[model samples]
Target: MRRSRLTLTLALGLLVVLAGCLGPLQTTPSATDRSTDGTTLSTTGTGSVDAEADLAVVSVAVVATAQSADDARGQVASDVERMRTALREANIPDDAVTTSSFAVYPEYDYSDGERTERGYRAVHSFRIETDPARAGEVVDVAVGNGASEVQGVSFTLSDETRAELRAQAIERAVTAARADADAMAGAAGLSITSIETMSTSGGFAPVERFDVAESAAGGDARTTFEPGPVSVSVTVQVTYRAA
Candidate 1:
């Protein structure tokens, strides 16, 4: 019996030695055992779509200067009233016409070693918005009646119109990006296996890039108003996994 017990103890010792030799098996990679050959690449693509402008905005400033503050203000007040009347007669709503600026300021001239008060300057500016169809008429009245100055004219999207344009623009951008991908693949002698990832942005419609420079030069010819179109554009970036 003692000999049997000695044999069992030796067997147990051998099993313990085997466990120590194996230690713990690693299932995850360590810092030193990392792969350096992996690569992540990026590329960008652009798309553009053009559409005609659908809306217009214009700024008109009427300036009148006189020797006295009351005179300057009174002239501006009279001009404003006539301007409103002209707009109303031209079929523009009072609500559509808004006052943007109304102020009276003093002007001075320093000459002959003395300072002299030139006069008081009063100016009133208005921003007018209306349908594009009859925009020409509105401008005509402003020039013909009391508004002698056209600060600027711009084309833009209304709230509802802008939202619609944004979606259409994105669609066009995506289509363009895919077309570019196909072209690239063809050039590389490879067909598009499949798109792994697609990201896009840009292409907004009816841009307002075209500026309408005011021609106060037409001082005598009724200001010869011209309501021109404007262009607005947006940029988009697209990233796709090159198959």
Candidate 2:
């Protein structure tokens, strides 16, 4: 009986030792160990492409003031109609011209620390989209036809052009990211086995504005404008695994 009990205790101790040896090992995180198993190199790459602007937007407003709001609004409406007619005659499509804003506000005059109602001012603003080459002509026509305020002119890429540029930018960004990863991996004496994760982001082109007077001077000579190139950029972040 004593020999059998000793044998059973020895067997149980051997089993416990084997279980401890076969268990999973735990390790703390380190610089190269971001994952549970820990082996990745992450980098961000950026690229940009320049494209010529194919379209332009011209903003104009017709402002009028009178003793009564009704009178001011009526005058502004008439002026806006005239401006629209001029734009149409200048070969601008009717659909391209749309009302942006219209408002009537009271003008205040403070002479002796007292607010007095001077008159009602009405403003009607319109945005016109056209080809870059015809931008100056459009502005000239609108201003000649009683457009009291010339907000500004801006240049931008058309929808189709923008989409094309965005695709190109993304492709370039990916290429750049891969090049960066290759360099990093080479330095570390490791080869990139696979891509663990990747993300992409797009950038918007800046709007180029033309310097024109607020109230365009009435003249026969058309205002010259320049539509500079528009640029689109993209960035990509890639996490690569090395073994």
Candidate 3:
């Protein structure tokens, strides 16, 4: 009777284990769903191209502090007008000068973990777009007129040039990816039959910074920079079906 009871317990355990395994087999994916067209070769490639910068964006601002908010705002406004006039006289078009920001806020001094209200501060910033060759001249004109702060200068390609370069960059990336895939397939004794999946992404905004403080301190002297070529880069991820 004891032997018969042990055999029955073992039979039940085996049935339970077999049922668990069969449950997963019922939901197994079909061969088509699990296939990758035999084998796949995956590769990523990057490419970059450089072109001369055609546009220069200069940031300048007028900052003022006074006992009252109204007084600070008036001071900043007056200086901004002066800067605008000087820029216009320097042949920068009115449309090229845009107000980037205008704000009047309270100034505070922190000492010994205590904050003290100082005064009101106002800031007016301008975004000036011009040719790369004349960027220095524009900066000088702004500072000499009324701009108290030279924010920064950046060189970039114009929209037309950027679009052209984007296409070239993508083409080069795809070419590189294909070359890598070919090499990989050949090494594995396989030939790439077709592309099973492909994706790409890339962009670039080349910036060469001109020291704002240095430009500001060089009083009456021309500020200049050799804005070098702007580069555009792109990357591609490709998965090729090989057989």
Highest-TM-score candidate: 2
lDDT of 3: 0.89
Q: Could you give candidate 2's per-residue lDDT for residues 1-243 as a string of tens digits?
A: 999999999999999999999899987889776745436999898889998788898999999999999999999989988988888788899999999999999999998889999999999998999999888788889889989988988888888888899899989998999999989989988888899999998876756656443435664455767778888999999999986
How well is each residue in 35-75 modelled by candidate 1, as lDDT tens digits? 54322223354434344456666678778889999999899
What candidate 3 gets wrong by more than 4 Å, as runs, is 1-36, 110-115, 209-220
Each prediction's RMSD over C-alphas, in Å, is: 6.0, 6.4, 10.3
TM-scores, in order shown? 0.68, 0.80, 0.78
Every candidate's lDDT: 0.67, 0.87, 0.89
Off by over 4 Å in 2: 1-38, 207-219
Off by over 4 Å in 1: 1-24, 28-44, 185-232
Task: State which candidate has the highest lDDT.
Answer: 3
Better of 1 and 3 by TM-score: 3
| Model 3: residue 29 alpha-carbon error in angstroms | 16
What lDDT is reached at residue 9 by model 3? 100
- Full-model lDDT, candidate 2: 0.87
